[model samples]
Target: MIQKLSNGFKEIMIETIDKLKSSDKRIALAKIAKTYGDGGQTAVAETFHVSRDTIRKGSYELESGFPITDAFQARGRKKVEKGHLPHLLEDIQAIVDGQSQTDPSFNTTQLYTRMTIQEVRDQLVLQKGYQDADLPTNQTLNTKLHQLGYHLKKVQKTKPVKKIEETDAIFENLHATHEAYQGESNAVRLSFDTKDRVKIGPFSRGGKSRVRVEAADHDFGQTFLSLFGILDMSNEHVELTFTASKVTADLIADQIEAYVHKLRSQQEVDTLIINADNGPENNSRRTQFMKRMIEFAATYDIKVILAYYPPYHSKYNPIERVWAVLEQHWNGALLNTQEMVLGFAESMTWKKKHPSVTLEENTYETGKKVEKNVMDQYEKMIDRAKGIGKWFVEIHPHQCKAALYMGLKTQ
Candidate 1:
């Protein structure tokens, strides 16, 4: 383009562009560049001692006849990612989000990340195949992280409700036993729990939205629903059951029975190791739950291990992680109906796979307890883990069936 122009014409073009305002100067330069057709920006940029990006922006303005309102242009600086590496933001999200998680309480949308800026830079090199020299500086990486809604602060290793006297020991025992079972071919390790009840109505959820009209100022939803989730640890397969009824001991056991049936149908599962917290319904001391589970084990002839996490340490329950993610998925919108709630939950992904959701409409009676004499029969079958009776209990299929056979000893 510059080669075709006379010295006088070249001088005129430069003078006119330099004299005009930012928007006008870009338009003039782009018009001249346009006349040269494709690859004109590079030639025009070189002749005018301008950046190729500037000429590119000018070309866009020429076509649209409007100044660019992009964040990069409006901010008065080109984003490093947009200008140089288009995959920079994607790689950053991949590295940090893999190590990050939603808050356990579902109180906030901010992810509780365990990474620092320096660590992210290290991970980019280690995981994303980026050369140390090619990577952005620590400050730049931190800026990018914040832009991606990642809060760059120290997060606890795992959010615990609080430290109990038996927290460490319980974790130690659970890990040791869970791993032992996980390694066994005949054992199927599971983490199961119920989420805190969600009120069904147009209530105010503490999430920001772009909607003009918002949820109700007060929570007036009298109807509540409970979500019971059973997770298969080896494969990321999860089944969620939601009910309008109170989450009772029977409902908990019923879900377990349904899952046991599914496992029996699909593959050979001799042992089902379930990880749970000592919640009100399924605690180790809950006699009704114990009796029901014993019956379930005996009927299926599958060994059951009722592994409970320590008191106040419900965060250690693997299913709680799924609940955290589900809450995040359903947060921003108004879950005003049962269908909406189910739809949102069904749409959420765990490990990039959707969960199997079912609405169990059957109402369950609360306060259902096992009588001492009946519990005594069930107790003959439960093998508590040494001193931690409330944390761990094992039920052998044959022992359970034999002891409770005809509501009396087999003998």
Candidate 2:
């Protein structure tokens, strides 16, 4: 068999293997190796530039008289991180969550990262203890960051606002303070807002469907439900809760409590940066809301920062983007039933992932407010930002402790 192979014939065999597909090429190489018998593996390996193990695999398949496949080849290439480092995502999340900055103008939800791609690359090596050789390239890291719902923005987006401030002081304050809380592994940043109520009735919301001016009430009569959406801004995590009662200060606090519990299970949460609009219920002076938050801080031993967007700027809140997507998703769908409403909401995807959805039937009174003296006690616990106190508020756990303790006894 060795004598049968001439110099030209060997060249021809190599050419033939090059032209054939992978499986065919492998089998052909195996056949060529069989001609050499003993030194066959080495000859095929060196000549074909493939491993001896590959030649052995080809030989085994030939003997088995069936087609075989290399699992790695069949699966194709995986994402850079998944193929090389399984922990890449968690590491990147830690890095970005530490470095995330919200847009002051509040136009986009993407984290305005302080670190460039190269810096993040260095952090992986310096901070995460990853070897440079083991890490993906900077470009790959950028792609991964994009996949993780983060991107760096150079310009601030400003709308023809109602001009809330002359020097952009309010916007600047939000940018500065919100950026401050980012990048702490122990801190969780969330963007939350309540979507407009949707009415569920026997009506398709198409162009001209309602023939009767007004119909008799159905079982689910005049059903209007409001949805509270929260986005974990550092990542693509979302939680959506639907409430049948009015969106109240108490309801807002209740949702926060629930979300915090869920987040605590995932990580050690020390500080919460909650980005919300200046809604009537959870505004800085909402006594019940502040009081509940104070209690929440004390119970969980966490600092809560209340970041409210400027007036009439609720559209800029990050969670509003989710509502926009949902509006488009459920626009034409027949939402005449509660099941349909929830089904549409659950089926819709924000950032390519569905949110955890729940329906809360408990009725929370809207006008509930802590008494002035009681609220003054709560206010003592709150640290309102100097100029924009109504928009940006901070409540420390220790302050909450002191305030709650002081309020425990009547003077």
Candidate 3:
């Protein structure tokens, strides 16, 4: 019966490893090593036909409390195209030359070829008069094609339906505003956006580490956390706030309120220019968020200029880059608790400076739309750009609401 059970376990291991991706297979095998103890490494190695050293390394990773998912990374031999395939790149490029999109308007030089590696091989063998022995296998040919910058990519789902005529003009305006704000001593320029949502519990994330760490078996939706971040353009300083509750308009407004208040304590900020994309929670049409912003400008007695980037271009916002750096900082480590997540974020450096992290435990109500009557009063304080109103706005203090129209620069 014991022998039968051991055989069943080996079958299960084989089946499980077959179903998993490369990194995940290592993690699963690591877990099994941990459970079996002393001879666990040997048992797993024999069952899986992997070297004992690989299993022993996994076991060590499990004990060390780091991540070992990428332990076997770059383990295989270099691709043939890198060294062995002398004429492969030139030959493949010639075949796909006609498919190149030479249009200057297109962002990239996209190839339109749909031929498979086998077809390519046949073409080289028959037309190019190369012997079958001289040609590499189809798999190697495919890798060679990729090394030559060819890919079998699917079309993007969200193609721009129509070009916004004023997109370039808006970007030009943003550049001018940023430069103008930077020139002033008492003025501030900031980029605002929400970072990638993270699950609060221990979960396996993509990255490589020297040791392996165990995470939760499954990811549940309820444990996710949203982070709203603001990047100070002048000093390269970042501020982060964590919200277990959904990222709502009111929440964004509150964070802005807190940020402006903190700035007021440091210096007498005259003009505040903020750059952000038109996200759902803080768009120009988001009355609640705008209402709070207008109130914030008025209370701070500063002129607030909201410079929005074009749709589907969140990368233009400087805050997005900050999030990328933070993600890399804690990619492999297991963020098991709220404190762990906050600690990791606080520890990440941008321009040799770490950000101040604040946890917003206060839950705000979602889908809270402002009343039309209240919004109408607030609208008078906001002046949007002509033809590109969604991409730009100026909010004046309550008392100086008429300032919205005074120097409205639509250029």
Rank list by lDDT: 1, 2, 3
- What candidate 3 gets wrong by more than 4 Å, as runs, is 1-158, 398-411
- Candidate 1's residue-wise lDDT over 146-183, tens digit each? 77888856554665557777777778889898778766
Clash count for candidate 3 is 3
Candidate 2, residues 233-252: lDDT per residue as tens digits? Answer: 87878888898888888888
lDDT of 1: 0.83
Q: For model 3, state the Cα shift of residue 377 in Å.
A: 2.8
* Candidate 1, pairs of clashing residues: none
Q: lDDT: which is higher, 1 or 2?
A: 1
lDDT (C-alpha) at residue 40 in model 2: 84
Work out the TM-score per prediction.
0.59, 0.56, 0.58
Could you tell me the TM-score of candidate 3?
A: 0.58
TM-score of model number 2: 0.56
Evaluated against the true structure, the overall lDDT of model 3 is 0.76
**Cα RMSDs of all predictions?**
19.6, 23.1, 24.5
For candidate 2, the per-residue lDDT at 74 reads 48
lDDT to native, each model: 0.83, 0.80, 0.76
